[model samples]
Target: MSNPKGKTYIVEHLDPELGQWSELEYVAIAKETQVAQGTFLLSSLPEAFNVPPALSQVPAFKPERRGVEELYANDKSRVCLLDPSASSDLGPDDGDKFDAFLFGGILGDDPPRDRTSELRKKGFEGRRLGPKQMTTDTAVRVTRMVVEDKIPLDEISYLDFPELKFNDHESTQMPFRYVKGQDGKPMMPEGMIQLIEKDADKSIDDLF
Candidate 1:
């Protein structure tokens, strides 16, 4: 995406376990190329729920090995390009900035029938529990472009991505707490929390 030095588009995923709060899964800022595209699972949740095997491995773009054009040739690939100057109409809703590109079936093996079945099975807890499915099974390819002036990363102070709310409110809010270090202080990397907070806010704006 093209923009002035200070602004950026923080790409993220709305955590299924944590409602309303969008997790800062990835970050995208302006770069010299002026063009950026990546492949992601379009129907991530459903795929995760139905066939967890497909969703086991984390998806990553090997642009250096394979060009974007060739990588996103099929319906399974979800691609998004961020442009700081373009309109914010790339996502599903008007405010939805993040784009859902391709819809893969899922990531890991199917969940066992019960706790005993789970113990007999193999895989981590996070992988065993399939991701929550979105409202629709169809996955839409998404793109987002914004102006540098509109988003200033430095201005962000807090960020959070809570689980989806099942009540009257659209979403629930959760604190982005940091782990305690040996010194008895919140053990977190410098500027990491701030960056997370900024990204969370950006995702929320897009969700609305």
Candidate 2:
């Protein structure tokens, strides 16, 4: 597989309708989360969105108030337009080479007709996650899942993620997280330990 690495970018093509401001907020949060997890994020906000000064200045946030159509026009290669209406599934062949990901960053029961037409004109390959529509944040997470190459975790491995861990003593409301057992040693699952150890061997793999 061609490593996506730094080549993949998530584009948040903002909807022009003023009412979509709430949807744009959801897109922004998703973008921030992806950025934290090491993905590039771009926001193509129309002037109608009136992107506030605070959001525009955020680190790793790229704002293009111009129409998102121009982005595809400028660079068509490896740009995938995510459309639930599209027939293509984002499988290994399509996801590996894709450099840019475009999602209609609007949240609603129905997609904007004009937006779909505009993206279609740009000739970006359209792919759908499934028959059902998903929220902007969910789409972002899915994008990362496809683009990132990693070993799939088993049920036992899932237990080690910090979010899934719980304090052994329910009576003690610890002020901080304790990943170590009562013996004062790291208490992670064996699978998690193996995954951690593999990091040193895979350091040269460049998927990080």
Candidate 3:
């Protein structure tokens, strides 16, 4: 994919302890979803980007997963870490300074203490995306919006998101509604109920 500013890559630092089947599944989904969103999701492992044959059609779908730390070491000047506690925020014209944006893929509630300290010591400037923590995928998307649209970091507010206006007849609204009835019964659509049941069954099967 062509990143007008330069080649944009998202690096995911996988946790060694997160070797669960479901956790690995989430990693695969995250990688594929980012590829679908026109960004490459790279890893430190050589075999991490071995996507299925169907997804191999897109050049951006294939992630470069070899010696990511070395790449950062080679281009230490361009390294930036998306940490909320950082002193600096990325500016509009800041996209061109680096080819890749790195994000840690820790699903835990708190940031990876050791990795964050290491990145800081290596001269990777911590850049804040928002006041609150964000999911790894959300961080990647927000980074794209900043880099691609050249939006100033300070002007970008999560609380004041872009409003979507649609004509009454345009049918842009979703048909699904999830709520609770007066009797405390679930007021979900039939399709949603089926989906929930299916997922619950799948979870139970996976537990065995």
Candidate 4:
């Protein structure tokens, strides 16, 4: 797939703190050149804040004392918000309809906090991926397949709530949707298993 002409994928970083989770996802999101020029991070950070070297693939924009609304105010109609609560699913034809696609960069909450509503209320055209909540990385990949590869939503394969096993005795389940690969595995961001194991081990420590 080639780059979508003049389309930039925007992630409005809503999380208060930068963590391993967002960093890995942003890196994965940056790999799809056909769907985006770059993973543009929009956030309010201190004047001295610098994007981590790992995220060099993503371009960071200062808040400029402007909120997401003000920053995109002029192009509101040209932006598409990926909102889970949206009534419609994004499709291949949307490639030429919008200049940019905006996604919330908040870490997902189980049962979903619907944090995207913050962006949704901005009144950009909204589209849904499916009924399941997906990690930011998966969402970007799916969107790329849909818009740039001209794949229909139903034509895409998916793995839901995949389980991660640390050992024969223990495992944890991710309460999210993921893209399924031809090898029959969930397409996950690199280092995600380590992160999952780290969280799983911490849960054990909490019980002590």
Candidate lDDT (C-alpha), each: 0.25, 0.47, 0.48, 0.70
Query: On residues 81-141, what C-alpha lDDT tens digit does candidate 4 reach at each position?
Result: 8888788899888877866677776635565676777777778899888888888778878
Q: Which stretches of candidate 2 lie over 4 Å from their true place?
A: 1-44, 110-115, 149-208
Per-residue lDDT tens digits of candidate 1, residues 1-208? 2123221222222223312211112211112112333333222132232222222332321112232233334521223332222233232232222222221111111221122222112211111101222111111111122221132222322222234343465443433322224565433333434544555545432321
Candidate 1 lands at a TM-score of 0.20
Candidate 3 lDDT, 130-158, residue by residue in tens: 55544343455567667666876555444
lDDT winner: 4
Q: CA shift at 138, candidate 4, in angstroms?
A: 0.5
Which residue pairs of candidate 2 clash? none
Instruction: Compute each candidate's TM-score over C-alphas.
Output: 0.20, 0.54, 0.56, 0.83
Top of the candidates by TM-score: 4
Model 4 root-mean-square deviation: 4.2
TM-score between model 4 and native: 0.83
The alpha-carbon lDDT assigned to residue 29 of candidate 3 equals 39
Candidate 4 local accuracy as lDDT? 0.70
In model 4, the Cα lDDT at residue 107 comes to: 35
Q: Please provide, for model 2 over 54-158, each residue's C-alpha lDDT reduced to its tens digit, 9 standing for 90 to 100.
A: 445654455566545555566676678877667766654565667667776542233323345556666778877554444444455455555554222111111
Candidate 1 weakest ten by summed lDDT: 134-143
Candidate 1, after superposition: displacement of residue 113 in Å?
Answer: 50
